[model samples]
Target: MATKDDVSQSARGLLKKVKQRYMKSADFNGLHISTIWNSREDLEAAAELVTARLVEVVGPSDYMNIHIRPWPTRRKVADQIRELRELSDDDYGVCLYPRAKALKRTKLPKKCEDAPFAKAMARGRSTLELAFFSADVLESYRNDARFRFGMGDFGINFWLSDEAFDGHQPEKDHVGLMHLGFAYDMRQYDPEVPNTPIVRRVAAFYGDLDDLTPEHQQRWASFQVGDDGIDPHPVWYASQMGHWPDGLGPFARLKPGAQSYQRLV
Candidate 1:
């Protein structure tokens, strides 16, 4: 059996490797650790060992971890929209697209008029869907079996460190570090497994804003959101806007006859 000191040493080595690899790779800020190691067990074991130290350095509320499973079919997205429509309040969601132009027209395209996800982006309309529903709704879904392996497709975390620490903090004053979680990468889009659940935890180390390079600044900003922003599908209108939410009203009128998930491959 591995001694406790051996395990800690191994975990420290893994953390150092990931932190270095994460900085060197483009867009690796929020990429899942599993993608780097190709093993969920390794990611979990590493997280278990270092998470306590991270908590000591980073505050609990400053970090986030989540499992995001994309809805595979258009029908599934439509069903979710129908249920969301029943919600009376729209505070959790805000419209972020077409910010350049105001809604000059109130009508949506005929082909997408009836689509549940379609929303008229006229003035004062909130179209993006926020994952704000009750937990019971997820529990009631029949496709719950897919949640096991399918949900954790991306798993990662992020941390901040200055040149003084060289991306590794001292034993003391490490409480603010917490586990930052998963994100979606459009390049990994698998048509056969469109709904594959992603499990990601992200941790990054950065110096003060003044010390960061321009590229580092951009990478730092991108991970603040939960997505990598590389999808090309029209159905991914919202994801293109940075894992925000899909906006179909504009796409429908602009690109008629286009179907959801049509260009995913």
Candidate 2:
């Protein structure tokens, strides 16, 4: 039985193959492939190779573009804190202003204070960053008559929510929707690479992704899945920094089950 992660991996692999076939057939029409992941290191490593291949195949000219949109750390912290406050009466507070002020005053490492979103928000400016593409893709698929007609046999259902910070804070429950992107792009590429069987196969796989609909794909893509479960904040933070909490120094356990419930035999 393939897990959702397994399915996602398979889907990505098929998409890569389809893209390759399409490039070969269409004289490389400046196809751009961008991927978002939970780890900057992993994303960078993957992008290096993919970018090289794209350059090799398309010869620049926007023929290949690969970007790794790691989760923004400072923005995530702000979002998490805001969410925590919204959920419960707990003083789930992070000293955003103090942290920024300290960094500025001391001229220490600017990493914490230098975050664009953090800096902007720290100044008491109203800000909203929308991950619209992810939403737009799903909407396009859902509303487009041509796409819907073509995908008649296929059905895609998608839902988006902030689940990464869930259960972590006593407040509002989950972080706001900061990280957003679409997982369904089969239709977008299908017509462009109709001649390529690989493209067709990839489209078919996604077309038949019944167990996991487009909504499920979107949710899973947004949240980070781990041994503990879905944790968006950790995933987003780790993605931005390219390291997990374990990589950081000693911190309280983010997950449970470490303590022995009973003495093992």
Candidate 3:
């Protein structure tokens, strides 16, 4: 089990870099999705829609764990990782690719309890990573049954796991360290290839920032509003990419080609 001790000087540098990028992104809504509460019916319906779509992407399985954005208590997602795939070495800590630009470090923010992402921040032994993989590989493997439902090898989590802890935190016990962000690698995909699975894009926040005297107006980051008592059994996020309802409006223009599991597939 990796821990704080495992965090090397180099690793800390990268973690800091990763957080900075996320902080900037949290404030960005242009290509971002925000969490919205769902009615019991809406929640169930959304889950059904999300699950149906996921099944088409990776197929079905019994041990699968799902996280709805902003729902809290996420799965730790270690077993979901496979050996680093096709991505290049330079892609490791660069959270935003052609989409978002990362900011350079200036003065560090004072650690504060109220700051978003304070608890779930990566510290100690955990280092961030990015990966790439194919859908055919996941479908062919038995252990990969749950992966289709999880942030996959090729996704942006390949950019950096949306959530990561220094130690081995299993999916069920995921608390305190709530890393988020799971997007599709829109840049790479092949409709004709079975093995060319869609790469899952991923990134996360390390709730470790502290700005005792925050600016009255705006800040660099914003997270799902709520207390620490978020439920992890199922986490929720807002997305218009696939066939899920996230209260379309500004996000409606996303045009994931209309909802439907088969269409998403």
Candidate 4:
């Protein structure tokens, strides 16, 4: 009676359990990147459109550690946005610039503010992403907002490198990864915990990730992401900042639906 999709999901569920058992056994030593974006097609189109610009401004590099991720804003974080916006301009300039700018670009109906659904927020759509580990690939975007949204409905993807993911344990890698993600998602133990769908998916899927071969690890080192996550820009800042769109947000105004929040409805 099970459909192909159902069968596949069942198999994946079993695999996840097995992986969890492994995680409990070994120390995890590897880097894992969790990325969010709208869709694969949109990601490709956006990446292709900007590839030329990134090369022109940053110059071609043999390798760069860049991750294209959307702003982690959802209707759930409205209060966070308000709080960040309230901070002294100098204290919060990084979080407000893009959001207020993007709001100007969109013709949000007056009613959009009160519905409590994503449709009511300035950018309920999961279009813009942040957290490129290294900026050389798209450095120009650091200052200007207009240049970011040139590709309509653009989203980005991040790659995982085993080199960045090392620790004393291999079996425990997925467990640590899941814990880290959950810690980020928890946001100070706030029960609302937004983006449940996507977050859960990452936790479940991580159990199945394969260990990177040595050649792959060496290839990743070429990106030279020295001490990034420790005080990682974009990631650390975005996590602390709360809302999705702001100075860090690309000038994306279309405001597409958030992938994780959609499933709850």
Candidate 5:
């Protein structure tokens, strides 16, 4: 039988190895540690080991959360993804995408007329518009049952395309070409009880800025609100000017009582 010290040492060694492997892989940037164990005791042990190692290696400032699940089904996975997306305070963060093809089909509305973006900007309406796949759809993978995987809390999913790492510079513009957003369900853990406090605490742990302070307000003036409860001068001006490549001079000339400038014609 293995002694307690032996088990502890073994767990620590495994965690160290895992962390080293992650650091060696260039593709694992911003990746978080997530694990699934065979038993509750094993899960807790692993969590403690992983958390301690991560804090020592990555620092205590890094935001980390351990998710424990008895048996995670497709619906359970989808629910978890949804919850994380809804609670995230970061400007950019992780979300779940069922699969590559499913991720590709996800898109924002093309036309501004009926789109949520247009409605939010023009009518001051804020609503969720993204389509989340049903659990039935998520479990459609051929090998999904063979392997058990866990995503970091509030982690994003990508289709793992060849173009993903192509020309991927840390400083330069590295746009995500293929991704899908998802949320998770924590209903089983807390049925009817709100997780607002937990979510806020996590946001604070991550140093995520949800609401702006007075100092931040002034600093972000160009990108923030204006006196008329609208966007700043440039943005408001652009909206009234339409989405044309040229300046607003052409559109302004069309207004009534405006000078018939030759250049506008």
Candidate 6:
């Protein structure tokens, strides 16, 4: 059995063929998304905790966009936190200042005139997310040298919207969406791309052709799985910055029998 759990012999054969076909069709040159935390529960807990914190500072909103990126030093991050704190008082601050281009095609609600950047953008659209950071959370990273040198763990994101997903691509309408990809000739390519186990299950199960709705059948027809391939940029940066925590590194311990699979084992 190629997978850990026993799959039927027929299913195994079908899965193998499917993977081969998918590889042929998938754009290996594309970028892939990965998570920083170990499990869904942890990720959710962190998000909820951040949401609570943000609510205390900025009034309720409908959405969030967490941004986790490298930082030069804690002082720099502290400086940014100070700026954000000042934004709360300055109604006409940069944080609330509207973008002329964003308002050109679509006029946002009058309420948006005084709302945060996140809420303003979501005035009319179905999805609106905002960038946020918590001083308390920053404290967690302050003492850790890894974060000080830029192996920072997390950031905060918030959003507000009155609409639910209607199955259209939000990326097409949204200006903030980012696409991370590598050229076909890049050296980071891996036959076994890194992904969470949950993603693996969804891909393995939905990937099969045993049953399909007519609409899905058409959608999968000639569908190019624009995948996000392995991104080692963080690891490379961590190593270059001289604080790649190995035994307890963010990307390490993903192998079998490690902490990530302890529950399954």
Q: Pick the candidate with the highest lDDT.
A: 1
Query: Sort by TM-score, best first: what order?
Result: 3, 1, 4, 5, 6, 2
Q: Across residues 156-184, which tens digit of lDDT does each residue of candidate 2 receive?
A: 23322234334253332221222232123
Question: Roughly what TM-score does model 1 have, to 2 decimal places?
Answer: 0.21
Candidate 5: Cα lDDT at 265: 36
Misplaced by over 4 Å in model 6 are 1-107, 110-113, 119-134, 137-265
lDDT for residue 99 in candidate 2, whole number 0-100: 19
Instruction: Give per-residue CA lDDT, model 4, range 187-221, as digits (tens).
Output: 22434775443111011111111122333223223
My TM-score estimates for the predictions, one after another, are: 0.21, 0.16, 0.22, 0.19, 0.19, 0.17
Instruction: Give all candidate RMSDs, comma-separated.
Output: 25.7, 26.3, 23.2, 25.3, 23.3, 25.7
Expressed as tens digits, the lDDT of each residue in 121-178 for candidate 6 is: 2221111111212123223323532222122221111111223123343432221112
The number of clashing residue pairs in each candidate reads 39, 8, 35, 20, 14, 12
C-alpha local distance difference test of each model: 0.29, 0.27, 0.26, 0.25, 0.27, 0.26
lDDT of 5 at 212: 23
lDDT tens digits, residue span 1-265, model 3:
3322344454334334334443343321111111232123322322232222210011012112111121221222221111111123332210111111112222323432343332122121111221112233222222422222333211212111324433453543222212334434544457776676544433333221221123200132442222222222112232212334433333333546435432543
Off by over 4 Å in 1: 1-7, 29-45, 53-265
Model 1 vs truth, CA RMSD: 25.7
Instruction: Tell me which of candidates 2 and 6 scores higher on TM-score.
Output: 6
Judging by TM-score, tell me the better candidate of 1 and 5: 1
User: What's the lDDT of the predicted structure labeled candidate 2?
Assistant: 0.27
lDDT of 5 by residue, 25-131 (tens): 32212223232222334333443442332211121112222111101122333333333333323323321111212112223222223322232211211111122
Top TM-score hit: 3
Please give the lDDT score at residue 230 for candidate 4.
27
Off by over 4 Å in 2: 1-211, 214-235, 239-242, 247-256, 260-265
